[model samples]
Target chain A: MNDAFSQLHPAASFAFFVAVITLTMLYMHPVLLIISLAAAAGYVCILKGARHFGKTLIYLVPFLIFMSVLNALFNHAGVTPLFYLSNGNAVTKEALTFGFYASVMLSAVILWFECFNVVMTSDKLLCLFGRLSPSVSLLLSMALRFVPKFGRKIRSIDAARAQIGQGSAQGGFIRRVKNSMKVLSVTLTWALESSLTAANSMKSRGYGAARRTSFSLYRFTVRDAVTMVLCAFAVGVTAACVVSGGIYARYYPSVIISGFGGIPALGMAAFALLCFLPQLFDAKEALVWRRLRSAI
Target chain B: MPQTVKKSRVTVTLTVIVLSAAAIAVETWLWSSRKYYLTSVIIILLAMLPFFARFEGRRPQVREIVLLAVMTAFAVAGRVAFYWAPQFKPVCAIVILTAAAFNAEAGFITGAAAGLISNMFFGQGPWTPWQMFGFGLVGFFAGVLFGGREVKTVPMLVYGFFSVLIIYGVLLDTGSLFMYSQEVSLKALLAMYASGFTFNLIHASGTVVFLLLLQKPVLSKLRRIKIKYGMLQ
Candidate 1:
């Protein structure tokens, strides 16, 4: 599943994320919210496995509940009063429902970002932005690469310090903090010195002598083109429907939801398709692989 | 070379001012109408536009790029290194030092890049953009206020104190306010700020401690490196 999604052109993948995440954040209709949440969760499970799904749910459920409760307590702008808070504000059904919608939206967006972190590899990001902003892209990719390298350096430094009995663990709280700062200062100095050599290496390589060119493995293939067109079509239709007031809901003063009918239904179907496009690709790839395996 | 550098610096400064002004105008309009999603997207794009403008005018040498990347990475690593200390990280101080030693442009890029890359491990969400903005502004102001100036510990510490307040106090609190409420209200905003005050204080103290302890050594080393390499001139 991961391989299937990763194999798509970076542009296509980026478009898919932009479309789904934008809609997930903007579209407040209950139907669209549910669809987005389910699709985001399903895709996350496919990409990250079930263990991560459980972990995310554990964190998100409480947060969702908390948000809903907070809104129910504070916001009293509704006709349907469930109860009155001690502050004399009514805990209205409309507020609770709105809170629930917000929670779902927040969770769905977070899930999409988690998927994005997995799918949008630094190299792919570089590929996407390199042509548009070469120096910024270079810096971004370099920063991404250096994070883990710096982490390793910190660990090694910590180990060296600990062996000499001046480690963070070898003292009281204040002393430990001081010790850690010592290690951090050393790492900062080392990083600065090493950067000079790095700069010199680039200088020797004739970097910035001319506009830089990079080797790219990704190509916009037929599949990528089709997927992008499909995604764009779905996004366009959904946006048109939204602008046309097909997917409309009101949570303040009164909880009013527009009737689900022709255009709203079509818009929802398109949105669901948009959110599920990656999963569809993953499923198709798996089926093909399984068939080929059985034949062999 | 110096002229070109100065020209680009002027252009970068102008772009930042223009974009921020535009963002403020957009934000005012959106807040009145309550378009939170659009506000988020617009602000993030606005925050990032200066980087492209700055680099587009004059392509940064690979040396500067690598150095900026390494500094960003160190800032991020510093954040993770102090994970044991809740709400306390040297990231803000590192960003301030980077901006002071280098330029505002490098400072903004380093802060933004660090916010983004660190969120990969910490978890990315809507808060990510606000975090990036908060940190980026810290770097930008540091550069704007203290760029190419002699190091003074007291002023740096004061700046660090306020920068942390803006980041953890104002920016993130506003994010929660929007996330939790459909409609904006003064009471809710006050409540949100009150709730987040303790955490912001911790973050502020962390920034101050890191600045007080690190400003001299880090700035001196970076200054010496700049002289030796003729960098960020």
Candidate 2:
């Protein structure tokens, strides 16, 4: 985020990052999941500033921990046993370890996407997929931006209804539920009326015309190319690692892995750098935002 | 003018019928050749019917219209997603729950469509039509909630449980039917899948859990989804 390398051309970088994380999931470490979780935390901290990291940490840490534990319990996988089940299934040390590692991979994938979400705004996204099912993509992307607003509008409508004594507050739980249904139905009708108005407006404005184009401004540069190449190189390395089993070095209770972490770790660090490289060149926007905030 | 709206709707219907026919043709070709493709083309046409059709008589509310489409899509999708899982599975409990709130038609459409469309993620095969029928039945029963007002839950849950039970059970038997290379009796297949009753229990329990957790959220959101999407008549 604020790593000064984050504000760069984001399209290829984002897809590149997602690709690497997804591919790495094919072969990764329990340590890597922890690292990913940590990186997620770190990435958030970098974005919103260290002050907000505490709140983010509070919310995500517990969930990640819970997921890790649940995966370990349910997914009795791996080659070496750490413990024996009462029904005689062994929790292979490898399985438990791999589960934990996979969790890290999952965390990385998630955090990486979150980073994309923050950096790649809707305007950027529209530009990214210019060729594919344009309508569907536009609609889905709009939904993403609009869904929260949609939820908010409903809440506000309900609150307004309550103010007008239209709420389902009386009678038994059953009756009250019935009333809520009626209220929701009425509210939905009102909402639809408004939507129709909007749609008609769109029709009048010639929204269905073939000439209309969704446009955005985010140009690609030479650095973007190098960054892409570097990222792709990392992706290739990640794939090569997974296929060759270089990504996950294991120590079964009986089997130990040593002297193997350095290369993959270096590869990941290189990727993180490429993914964040955009920020390094774009000082103006961040600086302006900082200035605006200071003035506020 | 309202007349133009009617005309437009009529035109859309004729177009949809043709489009649907075309899609079915494509599907039939695939079915004949590979016996499997995703259920997108058919499920989509089914989902869009209310949107395109102009009911001059009486029309369902926008919520009903959207929910109908969603319920169709959800039931089909959920069933398809869990296809390879243990037999006698519960999916599309949402449809059951919602239909119980509303009526049998809603439930049936949701379950049927959900079963059919969710296959789009993977491939649709010989089992699509059977799953479609199975889920559609679940929704149909759910939609028949007795004496419930705008909001119905108890009936929804009951309907969801039983409808899902039948849907999943029949699906298992029917699945066995499809898995066969040639002709086989339903009774024989049912006997074979009769052993999967435990798995059915597992599936039913899972669906019930999902229904309980998701019903409130989905119901609350359904109205809003209708409004936002301009699914009103």
Among these predictions, the greatest lDDT belongs to 1
Model 1 per-residue lDDT tens digits across residues B72-168: 8888877877779988988888899999998788788888888887886687676777788778889988998888898787888998998888754
Instruction: Compute DockQ for each candidate against the true complex.
Output: 0.66, 0.05
Quote model 2's TM-score. 0.51
- State in Å the error of residue B74, model 2: 15
Which portions of model 1 show Cα errors greater than 4 Å?
Answer: A1-3, A158-179, A290-296, B1-33
Worst 10 residues of 2 chain B by lDDT: B32-41
* TM-scores, all models, native as reference: 0.91, 0.51
Report chain B TM per candidate. Answer: 0.84, 0.57
lDDT of each: 0.83, 0.53
Model 1 has a DockQ score of 0.66
Instruction: Report how closely model 2 matches the true complex, as a DockQ value.
Output: 0.05
- Those runs of model 2 whose alpha carbons end farther than 4 Å from true positions after fitting are A1-10, A29-38, A55-92, A141-164, A169-175, A215-217, A221-223, A241-296, B1-233
Most accurate candidate by TM-score: 1
- What is the clash tally of candidate 2? 40
lDDT of 1 by residue, A151-222 (tens): 788779989999998886888988897887788778877887887798798889888888889988899999
